[model samples]
Target: GTPDAEEPTVTAWGLEGSSLRPGQPSPALEDWEEASEWTSWFNVDHPGGDGDFESLAAIRFYYGPARVCPRPLALEARTTDWALPSDVGERVHLNPTRVFWCLNREQPRGRSCSNYHVRFRCPLEATWGSWGPWGPCSGSCGPGRRLRRRRCPSPAGDACPGRPSEAQKCVRPRCPGCGPNTCGCPDHILLGSVVTPSGHPLPGARVSLRDWPGTVATSDAHGTFRMPGVCASSRANVSAQMDGFSAGMAQAQANSSMSAVATVVLNKLEKPYLVKHPESRVREAGQNVTFCCKASGTPMPKKYSWFHNGTLLDRRTHRYGAHLELHGLRPDQAGTYHCKAWNDAGAVRSGTARLTVLAPGQPACDPRPQEHLIKLPDDCGQPGRGPTYLDVGLCPDTLCPSPAGSSPRCGDAGSRCCSVSRLESRKVHCSGYTLPVKIVAECGCQKCLPLRGLIRGRVVAADSSEPLRFARILLGREPIGFTSYQGDFTLEVAPSTQRLVMTFVDPSGQFVDTVRVLPFDPRGAGVYHEVKAMRKKAPIILDARQSNTISLGEMGEEAPLAAGIIPPGAFRSADGQPYTGAVEAQV
Candidate 1:
């Protein structure tokens, strides 16, 4: 019979190309114990309803290795109305709970399908209403409880299928100094302080208990006033008033014998003064940062503002709830920051809090799990090995201007040179970059000069072939020392074989001559070279390509100077007589 005309017999079908074909019923359908074997690709067929009903029209099945294939299962009727006969096949009530295959398939072996398409109509699902507001906390402190509830829509029989409400424990943060069992102490002292908005003490200010009238007390020079034997098992309020200042009141609950320090700040018609200021912070580039400012002034300072790098912050960009919160901080957000508390009297600025943001690859510090010292990585840079210092700068290849552009040179292009003065095995503390990395014994920039090698040699005269003693030896125009009696000297030179200029100065600090020496071999820890000195003459220049040949007379002109000539006063004798041309002058 057509599905639209009468109750057509319902049968299990094998899935094919876009159609369902009659197939043998599951072999385990009669024997319930074997049902597990067919549960993968087989589901019991049920009778159809007469009128239109709600059901899943199509379902996609995924199976095989890595869920490769996707097959869609769809339901179709013989007629357009999709009407089913009232007298369909006998229906079984074995699954009274109406459990159907909802993508729950067991993997089968030996060419058997691991997943099968499912297309059928059952009944409309029951929908639940919106959840209610959470209930109040069960306790004031410690672990508390709260709950929210929801219900199924009307017309749903009996009760909802799942839980009607959800419950969870609410945690209450413990107040500082309010230990377990101490918060309820009945015996407590009533003490407080009177201060200006700036937190400065106001001595001789009158303070009186609010709950118990006439219980007056006068503040000491320290601004502290105490009232002993006062009952504060629950709460108490105290007021302070002084001349030329507005009155102020404070409230507190006595939790301990050491009553919480209640501060009553009296307002004055003057500029605001900060009582609390934000602190310097070092945090990740993308993180939330907050700053707090507390101040007091006349009219209670109604307006609050924040500034970054001396520029006022837009109110819409940052959140203010008793403190300033910068959401999702970036590198640009790092700078010196402060807050302002203002009113009709005047505005007061708080102490600046510096925020540092480190670029990638820079040394970073991560908090220690259970310790006060921060843990750093191994590559954060090393500590000082000795008192020696070196400067490093990034540069182009053309830096230092060598005759032959062959060696690497550091110039003042893009580098931050910082001195590492801390002793060996000590931590490296940088002011702007406070984030601690691995504390190494040797500290320096990422790229630095290699360890220097000692260059030992003797300087001798070229013509006489004799050792030149008491002569000054220089490395690259810098005088290292004067030659000893043996004419032997040792100098430290940085690694790398490069052209270097060494100048020799006579003992009289005159007659200086410069010579170009061949590059030293850096393969060894120390190098030995014998320098041949020549008499003072025209300057000598060396070409790196022909370094072996020293071309003299490159320096053109040498002007004459009357140096070493005694002045007129020194020529006169002690008698103040300019005696000359006579016999001898100390011969």
Candidate 2:
């Protein structure tokens, strides 16, 4: 054959060329040609006996004079084995009548020779495989689909008999309430509708409940949705959301059947600001006080904090509504108070307010008076000075010493002011000096009188200032009189050359004190001479007259002589009534 010539037509015959089979020839090749000189390709009719042609053995084709034919070309026929072309893709249709021609050119003993033959085998039967494990259900709660799959053996069976994977309805157990076993769950229903502001139904809105978080219902064309099998008497939250609207919520308690409806609307955002600021106040000490702060905003304030003097107060201690309350208020708690209100937009501070705590007992008063006025008169000498004769400065005998080289007074330092008759110490006051000093008989004074006169006086216990009621009084060796309930006693003695002794015994028969009145009183009228007594257990004398202040309730700081000096019809009471008689006289 010429180079690149088309393949020749092929015909098949029975053994020994006995007879030509019907349609034994294949379609003639048109543009196809041999790939190379040593190889060629051709199609065969059936070479096996059956018309189905299960196998092929040999291929014989008449060729032109060979340029290099093998020396011993074998004529034996067997199945031909060819290297399948890599470029031939999978699942391709193979021609039953085609044959592979593989030729080899080799020289043995200096002769180039080649041998070839064609062969065929019966197509292997396809083996089917067992089914695989079932796949997961396509749906969780309803009738759904599952699939199982298998595959025919690779390379040997290129085609499968049927579908590789088969799908069927999943065999799931009945649901608690919605399925065949309705008694497994409570028979409850949830029904609701979503709507616009105008009450028109809004379709395709999503409604969900917290109790069934994983489940949701979509509104139908009528904006109505229904869910069954919810637990009875349980609480749940229902919410609705859609595009171009804010989410709306409604609380639902599941019963035999629950019906909840909600409408959603959104508004523009706003910032928080104060509406009413807190006010200041003054309260009496130990009283309770309260303050309030109110505000306005789009979303209400979520929290509040109270402040005292610009410091944040503990939230747990006060009540809400921005209310700051203080109980048992005291002077120490007086300070500036304010409140802070907070919301999603921001926080705002209120105007500062003040809290003043007034003191107890006294009417709110000012500080003490500064200007001096003529002091009020009293039996205690002067109102401001206190209640005793020594405070009024009545000691006339003790005078200031004369200038150097001048005459000296009776109570002067070197003058004989004290005699043996006036033996005890005495306090001497000088003209130019403010303080006085004690002097004894050892200090000489030219003229010092003896303390010789009658003694009559009231007696009182110095520490308590209470009267030593019914006490025994003694003069020398004789008992004079017992002190009355008023702690008063009187005694008289002949002018004594020796110092006179005065003694007292308490009503309880307790020995009180003994004192020489001669040293205390020079003229000794003893009218203003009040005597003090001491307990014998500790026999120390304490002068009751040394105390400067005495308390008189309604007559506070008023002189006892003022009661007698009032003119007729000139008196007035505290309420400004005219000419009042004495209280006992009026009664």
Candidate 3:
């Protein structure tokens, strides 16, 4: 068949093929000759298209040929419809159906070049088309190409993501907000910030401390504050607020930090409340005593007033937990005491406590009596032969009663008589008795003779010039005489031719020796016979004719007088005759 001399008409059409099944072919022009060679081209209208067949079918019509030629070549041209497998496409399908043309070409003639162009269209609605034109194609011969477009869905799920699984809704821990609150800081810390009621933060809230006797601290900008070295177990009230926000309060724990946060809400400032401590027991006198009154309130106590028996006490006393101490208490200071705790908001009084005191007992006293005696001896020369015994007594003056009756007495006579003549309440006195005298028979002898004259003198204290008293005066072979309290004494002896010694003992027991008396001649007679010289060592002896006013100064340095001797001219025999040569001595 000759090639179609007349200009050939080419018409293109699109066919819809079921993806599930195949359909029969139809013949539209019997008299026309089918083209032996045709080329297939792909059109991609959209870059990103839905995977539905509407986009795949829209380009089918542009793949068909319109008219046939008079000469048929050995090449075959046919259209086949087949469903593309769902899994065979990429994320998106560019072309659902594929078309191809096999053709024969003659060798090159003297110099002729043939060129043909094919067009393609989508079969579905305009909105349904390939993503865009297929990629670059080869020249001349039919080009077969596979096109695919990726499908990317809008990011799935909600825009904002749900919270993480590990997240939790937790409320912050808080402190018990209140002043003088018993809940205090733990062992080694102070009160930090107090959080809001809803766990919000409040900064710069003042937190006054009420450590009983004193107020210690306030909150700072971070709602954190501290009182250094304050006693633990102290109570506190915490409140916080800003200018525009309502105030709130919470009883917060003290000593809370980052690891131990305290949530404290501050309430609006209000009138303070007061709590009173119980009454204390009475204390003993002379003991250190402490009385405590524990109280609590808002705004913290301003001052602690102490009282004893309704009188105010100095508030400077050392205190603990509202306690007032009385150092070294005395019995006179015992009484009822009370205390009042006050702040700007309010005040409270504690119960009364009574204190009793006792006095110490008195000391004991014991009594006893004492006594002594002074007595004169009966014989001056022989103290051992004097009164053997003397009476003594002691009477009570202040402590005890006096003994009844006179004090017992004793003497040389061996008599049990009450020698004390006068018996006063605190004094006693007694007199010594002498032996009785006895008469003797007369002897056959001449009548007795009288002794010669005697001499005497007085002795006195050399230093005091006072007369010596109770002094012993002795003459040889004669009885000893005692000087009177005035120091006067006397001795008698017969005139004889014997040496005489006169001795005088002063009250101080000193011996004074007089000059020796020489024998006197009875026949010799003189008005004043100075027979013996008064010695400086003895009492002064004056002549019998001289007055007895003999002074110690009159005695000169002469030998002591001997006993039983007489002064001259001071004696005569008992008979009228003066013819005595010797005479027996007499005392």
What is the C-alpha lDDT profile of model 2 across 1-587, one tens digit per residue? 12122322122211111122222222122311321122233234332321122112222211211211222111112223332211111111122233322211211233221122332222333556899999998755544678999978856435866889998755344355533221124456666667765566667778876434333788777676775644343444667766545456665554344332334332223566775576665556776667777766645675888877775665544554566667677675678888888876678888887776767653232222223233222432434556333321112233121122322221222322212222234443333333343322222223434445565678887656678888777654457789888887665533222345577778674445646453334365553457776544322322222322222222335654322222354443422245334322110
**Which stretches of candidate 1 lie above 4 Å from their native place?**
1-270, 298-302, 364-440, 443-587
Off-target runs (Cα >4 Å) in candidate 3 are: 1-264, 268-280, 299-303, 317-321, 361-587
lDDT of 3: 0.37
Q: Which sequence of candidate numbers ranks them by TM-score, best first?
A: 2, 1, 3
Give the Å shift of residue 531 in candidate 2.
92
Per the 3 Å backbone cut-off, how many clashing residue pairs does candidate 2 have?
12
Superposed Cα deviation of residue 46, candidate 1 (Å): 77
The global C-alpha lDDT for each of the candidates, from Candidate 1 onward, is 0.49, 0.47, 0.37
How many clashes show up in model 3?
67
Candidate 1 lDDT over residue span 70-189, tens digit each: 222222221122222112221111111111221112212221121222332223336678999999977675446789999887573635568889987565643334333323333456
At residue 53, give the lDDT of candidate 1.
Answer: 24
Give all TM-scores, in the order shown. Answer: 0.21, 0.25, 0.19
In terms of lDDT, the poorest run of 10 residues in model 1 is 90-99
